[model samples]
Target: MTSTPLPSPTSTSGSTHRSPARARHLLSKVPEVTVWFWLVKVLCTTVGESFADWVDARLGVGLVATALVFTAVTAVVLAVQMGLRSYRPAAYWLTVVVLSITGTLYTDILTDERGVPLAVSTAVFAALLAVVFGAWWARERTLSIHSITTTPREAFYWLAVLVTFALGTAVGDGTLELTGWAPGTAVLLPAGLIVAVAAAWRLGLNPVLAFWAAYVLTRPLGANIGDWLASSRAEQGLGLGTALTSGLFLVAILAVVAYLTVTRVDAPGAVDEPGTR
Candidate 1:
């Protein structure tokens, strides 16, 4: 008596097969989302706004020059991040920090220097982001940040991230231009929007949709926070000045990064640190 023949190669079990490349990619490249993730991200975007201003105006570096410098920094650090096999807080955040600055400068050039209308810039960035996301989804079939373990997916992820920062810059500035709202008041809107997104997420909204919605809102919220802290009271801010504001946020970000490094609280695939929310 012989055993029954095995199922054909097209069976559902084949669905789990992995290529060597994809197997290597199984080591996640991004950080686990946590409270610290949002905290540092907001601070990074804040520095993106205030630090760019300090370099351009306070230090007299000029916008184009500062943009060029940060663009170069982004390229370099992004290379390092791409080379890494696993999540590294320092390199990952460095890319984000530089990307934030680059994105902000880009919007500033379009609006302030080239005299492009804020509404137009907002529309353009929105279209560009849509295109990138469309391409990314068409190719990978998914945009969840959790799946960014492969090179192609990682590239798509970063491209989307860059566009998000740029889009956020445009939206944030456009909101202020349209309403003529003060930083104190301007921030309230995005802040409210974020709270609403969080509530929706808790109330069974799609986690991915909620995550991205909050991600985009955070850019404007963080940028407004930067402006509010750096701008003079005459302009509806706390009047801390850009340099001081940048320094403070930079320090706070560094401290959080250090903590994450030691505790591995945000390490991809690692156990969540005890007491995490």
Candidate 2:
């Protein structure tokens, strides 16, 4: 039998050429949701929570004042982010970090300043999150982060994110109060729950459901880690202090965002097909 000629390398590369239109479309949007996205997000939230505490507690800014500062900063960052036509990782992640800090402070204000119990705060935030989700779903007809292409969707996305952080803070703190666990031990519950959620998703749970579940869980997971790292030894922590813990995670988030910006690692593309779990 005659041997068939092997295809040339040039031909193989040419066959893989993406149309300019497709390339442009991909470049003009946010990246497909991935593991890296979640990992960095958790780190950012951790930094936001710990750093806010550090500034208020160690630096003596006070909770209310620090909350006000973060609120202003978050507003400015989000405004800039909203003006962009496409997702930029640095901008997107910066907005997230700010929102995380602001959201945490919002819950703290309720629980600490207003003297609301953690359970009450948790219930209130959870209800608020539900309301945001309802509005987002009603307006956009889609809640998947994978389809965050329009201004309305992005707005809703950020709003939902803010609520999740606030809710997570209340829940995590409430759990601690109920169980009376130290910081180190407290980390395990949320972390374990998130792992279980991931496993369930892999086992064919609804993608949207899984995504939101994991998203909400990460706030507590990250917060616990931050607390465990930053609190004093008397508090059953590693004693890095909030300032150092926050600074470390912030630096890591910044480094990752910079890399993603340059590489366009998370940029959206048509290749990212939406999937049902």
Candidate 3:
């Protein structure tokens, strides 16, 4: 009747230790949580918002058709990602960028094409995220990103990320609809909430909880920022156009990912964390 010990928070190399066989078989599939991680995440989210819109508008195809195309692309990218034994910054972030686009499109389809209300979409996506989390926790007993060293854990992680993007889209757009606020003004709420969550994490909140909270908030914050740049002056945006905004963010993401790939700074088992470097 011995009890399994809970994992230590300060695990070696920022991850729970495993045997050589296990380690060799299941290299970490996620990047270390660092400033670069957050930066790229926000960039991907911004691209999710603007790029999807730009593609749909230019494709001459309907929303549902656009969604289907992206869905197929997402499946292909995710398959490639899951097949990898170790984390590659390019593959990993490419998958994320596609997933972000796919998720945003899914929400747009529900609200714009299928005529589902944003409130309903938000509630549904939130419930889906909760179910994914619950099932993951029930099976794995931990939700820490550092534990994503197996196929099942990685699957759960990706599923949770997709749902969060959809839910964030629904909530962000719903707020705009309800408040009639301009996109620039709308960005402030999620941005401020993210800051608050970070402060709470500094003040003893759980790191896992804080990370996911900030992750969810970033979708809306980035989306609103994208909208503000793309929308016309009449809409209180800078009128940069979706194409330009997407291009700028894509280049920024490439630069960051390139740095990480060359330095391996954010790779799992890296010695230096964000600030320490």
- TM-score for each model: 0.88, 0.85, 0.90
Task: Count the clashes in each prediction.
Answer: 0, 4, 0
Please give the distance, in angstroms, between residue 33's alpha carbon in candidate 3 and its true position after superposition: 0.7
User: For model 3, where is the 10-residue window of minimal lDDT?
Assistant: 1-10
Q: Candidate 3: misplaced stretches above 4 Å?
A: 1-24, 271-277
Model 2 stretches astray by more than 4 angstroms: 1-30, 58-61, 270-277
All models, RMSD in angstroms: 9.3, 9.3, 6.4
Candidate order by decreasing lDDT: 3, 1, 2
Please give, for residues 171-270, the per-residue lDDT of candidate 2 as tens digits: 8888899999998899899989878877886676766677787788889888989999998998889999888899899889988788777776556642
Best by lDDT: 3
Error at 214, model 3, angstroms: 0.7
On a 0 to 1 TM-score scale, where does candidate 2 land against the true structure?
0.85
The 0-to-1 C-alpha lDDT of every candidate, in the order given, reads 0.79, 0.75, 0.85
| Tens-digit lDDT string for candidate 3 (104-167) | 9999999998999999999999999999999987766777777777777788889999999999
Q: Give the local distance difference test score of model 3.
A: 0.85
Clashing pairs in 2: 30-268, 31-266, 31-267, 31-268
